[model samples]
Target: MKRALPILAVLVVLLAAIAVANPFFLEPAGFLAFLKRAAPLVILAAGQYFVIVSGEFDLSVGSLVTAEVVIAARLIDGDESATWPVIALLIVIGLLVGLVNGVVTTKLRVPSFIVTLGMLLILSGAVFLWTGGAPRGALSEGFRVFGRGGLGPVPWSVLILLAVGAAAIWLMRADFGKTLMATGDNERAAALSGVRVDRAKIFAFMLSGLAAAVAAILLGGFAGVSAQVGQGLEFSAITAVVLGGVVLGGGRGSVLAAMAGAFTLEALFTLLNLYGISGALEFTVQGVIIIAAVAAGAIRLPWKFTPRKGDAHAAS
Candidate 1:
């Protein structure tokens, strides 16, 4: 909770600023709309948090999202009856991608960074090849409903975000979550203590993939289908996680903080837009934020790593 406070504060401040700049944001309708728009990224950040906290990366998720959308558009092809099956298939695809990444990295001894990067390329190339430079087919209204529709004043996307957030928090509080943290903090010690470190990592990758699938669903309906839909989302998710005070090279931070970081990021973009800043500067801002975050984490490492006398006793 402490780690998440800074980002939460930042988010609140940014929201206030946006409200001032555009009073419409103060309204329920406008606010929910904002949440709807930010939900996909927030969900992706939550998924990325699992992998990051467990000492890994999931660069393939961005491209995975793109692939999911492209695949969905093709499979469903505006056929209302095909929507659910395609959605299910997308989830499966996400899991498969994550599984391969985890297996290759953990079993084959390839670095996760390399594994996921390669995955990103493979997915991108596959999408390009399949689509032949332009994606065909249309999304059915039933498919778009998840991204564009709401129950009364509340959005379906926002509801999905809440569910995902709650699940992420709960999972982090469960046994698997504890083991994952331990694995990230000290893999050898965790393994010695009976934790299946590799398995946990594989699960993390799977969760990330699932998150990508959900995000794709929301994004496809909200932003429509395109090869560029998930472009650079991987970096954006990473940036959000680090900004939330999660350390890189893994083993620290809270899922709550990671989600807050996503909200803060969305708010920052809203602020920039209100101020008439060029959207092209978005990547530049993200680069600066990531570097600063990693540097900050490095500076704090010694304090975080130093063991208290009780730690040894507690382990024993």
Candidate 2:
């Protein structure tokens, strides 16, 4: 029941603001479209949830998405015949990137934040070198299908989000999930219990990378290929996860809650746009969100304890 509150609040605010801003937003199509647009970020948030819940960070996902999209475009080069191969390559690249992240963080004992930060720079520089500023090639029609295509009235991206959400929930309930949670709660204790802490961390990084890849595919289709297609998405994903009530240091929150946080963010952005707010201010908004959420969590513990007058004297 506690897990449901964040989503309910998210829905309430979403519905109220959308309805108030534009009555058309209440219509099915309108809402569905919003879901479709928000799908990539939502999925990204889910991926970020895995990393965050595991007590780590994955800052490279944004640039990884960019790299994947750019690589897809250049390799496929509008060749419908090359679509399947390129996509497979993209997935492999994503997993490999994740593998590297996990291995380095666990084996070298470096902080994930630093490792992923380095990865972010590496990927961005790679993209810049590969594309030379302007992106080349075009997404094949087949490739674009996932982003723009749908099953009857439903968007594929939205369906993927639902499926991923379900999978994440199931994962959190599995042995791996339990151990992962334990690892986040206390790495030393988890390792002492024979949890294969390194392996677990590796797997978490891989999951995050896989999520970024999937998001890249959808985003590539929806937003089209560009050098800047995925800029700052990593931060957005982290913000969404934090907003979902996942504790920053880990050992708290549900996957469903994290994903709902992503939806809430999108809805908030939509509301912001409706009220004539500049999109340029999104970074500022995200900054506030991160600081405020962390601060709120920090204060929550103190909130429940009011000082008792003369308590020390009574004990004496």
| Top TM-score prediction, candidate number | 1
TM-score of each: 0.93, 0.91
Candidate 1 C-alpha lDDT tens digits along 145-213:
999998887999999999999999999999999999998888888999999999999999999999999
Task: Candidate 2: list runs displaced more than 4 Å.
Answer: 282-286, 301-316
Candidate 2, residues 184-260, lDDT tens digits: the string is: 87788889989998888899899899999989999999999988889989988998888787877776677887888
Pairs clashing in candidate 1? none
Backbone clashes in each candidate structure, one number apiece?
0, 0
TM-score computed on alpha carbons, candidate 2: 0.91
Among all windows of 10 consecutive residues in model 1, the one with the lowest summed lDDT is 301-310
